[model samples]
Target: MSQLRRILVDAFETEVALRRVFLWLPAAAGAGVVSYMAADREPSLWLLVPLTAAFAGLAFLARGRRLAFFLLCGLCAFFAGDLSAAWRSARVAAPIIDRTTIGVVEGFIEQMDFRRAGARFVLRVHAIEGLAAAATPYRVRLSIHRAPPFEAGAYVRLKARLLPPAHASLPGGYDFAKDAWFARIGGVGNALGRIETAAPPAPPGLALRTMMALDRGRNALARRIDQIVGGDAGAIAAAMVTGKRDLLSDAAKDVIREAGIFHIITISGVQMTLVAAIFFVGFRRLLALSPTLALRYPIKKWSAALAMAGAVFYDVATGSRVGTERALFMTLIMLGAVLLDRQALTMRNLAFAALIVILTEPESIMGASFQLSFAAVAALVAVYEARMAAAAADREDGLILRARAVEGERLRLFWRACKNLLARGPGGLLFATFCATAATASFMAYNFHELSPYVLIGNPLTLTVIEVFAVPGALIGTLLYPLGLDAWVWRYVGLGIDGIMWAAAEIGRLPGATLHLPAFAPWSIIFLTLAMLCSVLWRTAVFRAMALPLAVIGVWGALCGPSFDMAVAPNGEAAAFRGQDGRLAVIASRPSLFASEQWLRADADGRPAREAVKKDACDKVGCVGYLADGRSLSLVFDKAAFAEDCGRADIIVTPLFAPAGCAAGLVIDRDELKETGAITLLFTASGVARRAARTPDEDRPWSPAPRRKWGPSSRPFAASRPTRAASSDLDPSSVARAAGEAPGSVEDEDGDASPLE
Candidate 1:
């Protein structure tokens, strides 16, 4: 302890500590935001007051000591993050639909998106037929089957089935409700009937008018591009420029996502940097043409300023998302660094940019886009920095200069120059891609429970086409469109998009291209993130060495985490259980597709739902699922089946309320399911472990506790005498070979496996 204190004191007193102290302040702030987000219950209203006061008091008390002062300042930043998130959450608080409703919805269209299934409209609600004014949400997202006659800002009325924002289906799944809450989106549903135009009761504000105009212009540009390029390629090209991603089919999106090059389609750092570089290079060369004037002026700074302006315009023009805005912020900061004659590509600049983003949207810390984007950038930058340092060292030692001076080495030098080009171009891109993929793999698994193993190949192929063809086409096409000569440019743009799609398809079809894994505890992600931060951000070798063990622990935890034996859907319409063969046995032939898909992903089972439910004995009465331990779990539909199921089965699940006396060891009925939300159970050799999407203890506004209309059974099933409580769970077929079974082999349930009924 004394040695540690001395080390800390010495660190703070040194000049190096000054730089290191500021470098970690943003991370400290993010840690505080994470703390706030991880809370099961909301903190008190005045909690920040005490936190701030404590920080201030500590700072003043240790003002004379630099070490203590630095620690207190970090504490102050932490407090600020927590306070910022709380205030932002409160500011965005809006009414969310509590229950599903079929009503006439009237509103001005705020946005429209094309999807494979239908068009989605974001409505600025004027009214909901059955809901009161005070209860109605300001914004509602609705899926409309056909193209609406009107565009954004056009007032319209439609009959729709609107539902309350939904929570995740199972534990550790994405929380849509939380995202909706932060986005101020109160409800989401499908339009049922015709949409009719209606006059607005009041004129929209000036800001709304400007936003609507921008949307209209984007639509026009997309239409023009579609006319020239055509097909899915054109739609993709437009998406790259105008952000109309809904134009692509879901299959295409899936292919791209699985290939791990989906970032290219989105307006992210790659696109933004490409845009900035175009202007910066073009303007710099243009100014260089006039050498007399260029030598007397700061043309590089002028070019950087112009590039930043272009990037900002592109971000706004493309319908800026959080990801786009983040990329734009980084670009602006990098360019601003150039203008100020400061090094732009350092981690310090990245940290400064991160601070701005964290302060502006603290809630984004919980989002996949924010995490993945920043992680990828940090990894690439760190790798580049290391590479530059090594190259500089070689140059300083005169290794290259000394070798180049030997005339007999000319042929070797020529080959070496070619190799260097390869290294700087494709080889460099490949290495950078690997670094980014490695950095984001944990985050990817955390968010989607999958990893794109072939991303190393896929990204290089797609991104090369993007940087070489698509970006240039977009720039040239947009410029020449006014002159009525962009048609030719778009044709080549379509060719480039075709290359990207072809790569996506081929890579996606590769065996084991995507590895889906079971969800792990949140701590796994935290550990992995910490490991990456320590590895890249620390200046000392001792601190950096800590990353290896942290990474190992994180990987071990993620891969060896407990897998749930069974999962029930949020609405009690579907459920799946792990079979003896280790594959999922969905209980319902006609299960909710979304629920079934999510359940399969959570289990790391890639089979389609129809294939998974084939062996289940499902009928109008109910379905019976066989557990690995030879126990049966019955999903009862008709109450008549309850008598037989409750007597024979170990567990019973039903939408209807269970009878007073159930012989089953466990029962989860409608009321219980409603209160608990979706549930997952892990039946291990020790015992049965249960988890829920939303528990009674979960008090977040996004997932409130349901109003209990009925009480639980008085009888304790555990106290029943006949059914013995035993730890007799069997291992999956992978390990059940000891019990006279072949590896990955088990007898199928002797029942029908027809299809989704």
Candidate 2:
């Protein structure tokens, strides 16, 4: 307790800049709260407005304590701001939910992605036949069979089938709707026929024209790079320079991802910082060559301004993604500090950058890119500041220490040799790599459910090539693009890229190169983040020690065992049942690689899809199988199987309407699955419980409740007469009782049951 108290005192006594950084903490917390609330449920303007005003009033009243009061105000303001942002975002470019219609859609192509199978693009809708103006989606994503000459900003028309953005494929899986909601993508579909070019070629309005021009330039550069360095190498080079990663091969992506160096291809803080450094040094050297200008002006400030300009150019050249926006903002803040003659890389500067990003794009708080980028920066800044402080302390104590510590010449010489060996050679580089790897590994695992065990080896082996050759070569190539002389630079850049790819592939092929992990509960990430913040933000050794236990506890919780025993897809087309060996066996009637991958990744099961498939007694009717616990389950396809398995199987899953008098203890048919979305079943000694992808509380505009309608009833199946022989499975009485139903009785006459009920 005393040690903790001392740590707090030390933190308080730290520099004002350091103290100011902590003020952003509460504001971020508030933004995070609002983001989660908006994700789970609709934001109520009425409730948030009054709540914000009330907090503002309290903060005003507490103004005598200025720091605390301002902090409180920041929290409330950001909270309200985020809620308002979410509400506004939900209404923008609303999705068209009518999926049954196929019509001719005309729109301007805004972006294009070329996958191995085909090409996909996001189109800004101008008109849609057979649909009302208000009902038409603002933007639609279309997948076509082949790549067309349709560049970005080109108007085109095509016959397509449009539907609402996809929901989560499984419970706790990726939320495509949420991502699309923020990205302003309203609908997704496939192109049914050939795409014809529309007349106007370009859109009206100054902003649109400017964007079109920029995109044209980007396309030209990409083509030039492709011509210069053919194959996957050219694709990767183009991606590095222009953020056009669609052409990259899946094998290359896999190698990069497995090696944990995928960030190199993306324009992020590393690329932005490197660009700025290049500009700063180049400008400073050029200015120094002019003696009169160097003497008359503040050359450092001039260089900093030029560096800021360079960062802005790079931001645009790289497609200006959210990550690029963040990098630009931070770069601006650092250069602004130089302009104001203050320290550039201070915690307060980072906090200001974070504050600006959160206030503008509140949804970014939940993104993995935002979280991981900030984590790495925060860790580096904290370590740098602590090291600087320690050095200053050492300088102050040097005189007093020298008199007390006069050592023998031989011992002193030996100590100096050891220090030089550790501090100035490969040891230093290795240590830096270790710190960076450690700082990013946990967050990477949390977001991606995998870790690259060989990153420590991979990064150091490739860092020099990337820093000295690839980035610089790419930058030079981009600068020369206007003159059609980029090929000279690209040739060298391709060589460097080849080296990086080779290193990644070799390291990724090593045994146990990657470690996959299960999905972590939300609170686990929060706990780990808090622990990291405590360890880094505090100044004293005692505070770091205090955080150790918390870090350990968070890690343990994140790595805990899986919760449910079985997961059923929302469509009733597939299910994964856990076996006694703790492996998941997938029973899928149809091939759905997306859902299968999601299940495997979520379970952290490293097995391939072919290996995980369960060979069951499947036929045209359905498949019946026993789980690891001897719980018989029958997947019914048609009436024949339904009648045969209804009374015999412990649980029955069917794609058709539930037949009347069916006696399965638990039945998940099309109706229930459609209403609740995907579900996971938890098998305990007492009974079986279920969890739905969407709950009642998740009643947002994007996730509406399933509609109800009376339909023709299927033929009644007698429960007393079973065609199939009853296997030695768990009794239906125990399962029904655990579900809070009377033995041998259906839970609901309407066949509508709550997710778990």
Ten contiguous residues minimizing lDDT sum, candidate 1: 745-754
Q: Evaluate all candidate structures by whole-model CA lDDT and list the values in order.
A: 0.76, 0.69
lDDT of 2: 0.69
lDDT per residue, candidate 2, 1-757, as tens digits? 9996876766555623346546455445445455654466666667767777887788888879866776777767666665556555655637554443578999787776654456767788888889888887777777777777767778888898765665665676666666666666666767887889878644566776666667767777877786788888888888777877777876787888888788767776777888888999999999999999899999999999999998998887678876778789888999888999988887777777777777577666666777777777777777677657755665565545556676654465466557656744777667666766666667787767899988877777566666776679878887787787778888887888888888888888899888999877656766677677766666656556656887787888787734677777665666777776878777756535556666787788766655777755566667766788877878766554554576678777765555545667677776676567778888776666666788744566657666755863212222232444343243444433322311111111111111100
TM-score of 2: 0.85
For every candidate in turn, the CA RMSD to the true structure comes to 8.3, 7.1
User: Candidates' TM-scores?
Assistant: 0.86, 0.85
Query: lDDT score of model 1?
Result: 0.76
Instruction: Quote the positional error of residue 340 for candidate 1 in Å.
Output: 1.9
lDDT of 1 at 87: 78
Query: Candidate 2: which pairs clash?
Result: none
Tens-digit per-residue lDDT, 1-757, candidate 1 = 9998777556444525537557778888898888887777776559896886799799889989877887998898888788878777888888898766789999888877755455777788989998899999988877777776668879998897777665666776766677778878788877888899988999999988877877877777787887788778888888887887767765676888889888767777788888889999999999889978698999999999989889988888889877777788888989999999888888887888788888888988888888888898888888888778766774564566565687765666576567667768878888888888888888899877889999998878777777888789888988888898989988988888888888889989999988988878768887899898877776566666779999998988897765788887665556788889978877753565555667788788766555766443888878888888787888877666655676678887776666645567877766666677778888766666887777466677677666644555222324222553222222233212211211110001110110100
Cα displacement (Å) at residue 361, model 2: 1.8
User: Which candidate number has the best TM-score?
Assistant: 1
